[model samples]
Target: MKEQLNSLVLKYQQTNDEKVFKEIYKLSVAKFHPTFNAIAKSLRASVDEVFALYEDVLLRCIPTYTGEGNFENYFMFSVKNKRANLYRDRKLRTQKEVLECCLPKDDDTSAATLEIISEETPEDTLVRKKRADQRQLIRSLLDQTDETTINIVEAFLSCERPTPTAIGKTLGIHHMTVIRKLEKLARNFDSKQFGDFRDYLIAN
Candidate 1:
């Protein structure tokens, strides 16, 4: 596995060519596709539509192909959603005339099938929620630090405006105290999974 990943990284570095993706597809799809197709069909898509979407997914994943674990897993999430969207859109469009004839309503009474076709597993959704909560928690945590920490973080958030040196001076500390505290804030409060974005407060 390590060797294969190394080879892929080398290939990626050597050429940004699409053939590397084809090679990755050829190498990785032996046991992956059948299991993937089963998962998609289980999610309510028809077998034929699942396969068609699988082809499209392979093309999408091609650019990001790598000999890495769970690459296919992420792509499966994306492909399942794409398949669901395609099916829903096509179904709605095909029935447009019938729908118009049945009721002169602007919107159809029927609900979209996409509501049933969830691309994210319950675990994935929970993980995302937990991560978001963690980030919010981190922000709150930073707020509880000394006023200097809060001021520094707020300054970083202000993109156009200059950070007042007086915030540092008001703390009765050196100018570098702000920078050092920012690093400590990241260490103690920021998330490892998402990286400490105190470095990019202005980006918020």
Candidate 2:
């Protein structure tokens, strides 16, 4: 592996051919697709988003390759770190959206009323209440599940964004078992309770 990576690196360095870069990029994608795809599945991101991130990570890693140690391992590490950052950024964006939803409207021109509702506008209050209700419904659904199912579901929903495969490894179960658990979770929640995210685990 080391020799192959070194050869690729030297070829790119000496010839300065973009084709070498392209070849290396393809190799990287093929080798690390599983790792990156798992991260995406864990985060419940679309396949397109994960592939886009994989490409970005590959491009960034290629320019900085030192050809030391295991190139595949180093490359996978970089991709995983990038995925982690993407997850964090996504979570932050979601939080920001929720906060923005809670803010007073531009034309909320009632001074005394504003004083009474200084923290949040009526619209914001309603949005938050709705979110709270949804959360409660989800919690109720989860409560009906067994311990293993609960653990599997929580792991899927974690910030770490562990894939079903990763969760299976952690729980000493088969990857297919993890997938089945997720399907069961989807079945547990009604479409109305889950809204458009009804089959979230399976969809991801």
Candidate 3:
């Protein structure tokens, strides 16, 4: 696979043919479709989004493909890095939306009031610290879980309209299993803290 991909890349570079580039794209998807699906599931992204990223990576990396090292590894590494970046950007957007909702609207509040609201109060600091501690606790619990369970939890929290059936289908598990695992996981956290943990997981 490595040698073949490298040869195709070399050919594309030599001729700069659109047809050759299309063949490269086709071969890449055929080889890496499973990887694309895995990344999409992990990030709660659609398959199309993952394919779009894959296409972008191919375009960006092909120009620099020196054929010095393993092309497959290089391509996959780029894909994984881009997936991480997409996850980070999504998290940032979620956090921003949450923060925006918490802030007073400009139309309803004066500039002085908005300024006051922007400043963190002592109580707000305390609340933030407590939430951080809760998140740490949740993270520890998650660390104890198996990879499948963690993936389940992430899918549950990140999906826009999450349901046990949908999550199970996405993860190739049964709906009943999804419910059971979720319930078992929820029991690990205190009833009051669970809400904060959910919010923390969703935002982070």
- Clash counts for the predictions, in order: 1, 0, 0
In terms of TM-score, the best-performing candidate is 3
Candidate 3 per-residue lDDT over residues 39-100, each given as its tens digit: 78787777766755675566557767888997777888998898899888777655554222
Report lDDT (CA) for all predictions.
Answer: 0.52, 0.61, 0.66
TM-scores of all candidate predictions against the true structure:
0.31, 0.43, 0.45
- Candidate 2 lDDT by residue in tens digits, 125-159: 76566656655665677877778877776665552
- Comparing 1 and 2 on lDDT, the stronger one: 2
Winner of 1 and 3 under lDDT: 3
lDDT of 3: 0.66
Q: In candidate 2, which residue pairs clash?
A: none
Task: Determine which window of 10 residues in candidate 3 has minimal summed lDDT.
Answer: 110-119
TM-score of 1: 0.31
Identify the runs in model 1 with alpha carbons over 4 angstroms from their true place. Answer: 1-23, 27-49, 64-70, 97-204
lDDT of 1 by residue, 38-93 (tens): 75555555444444455445434544556465555656677768767866766664
Which one wins by TM-score: 2 or 3? 3
Indicate which candidate wins on lDDT.
Answer: 3
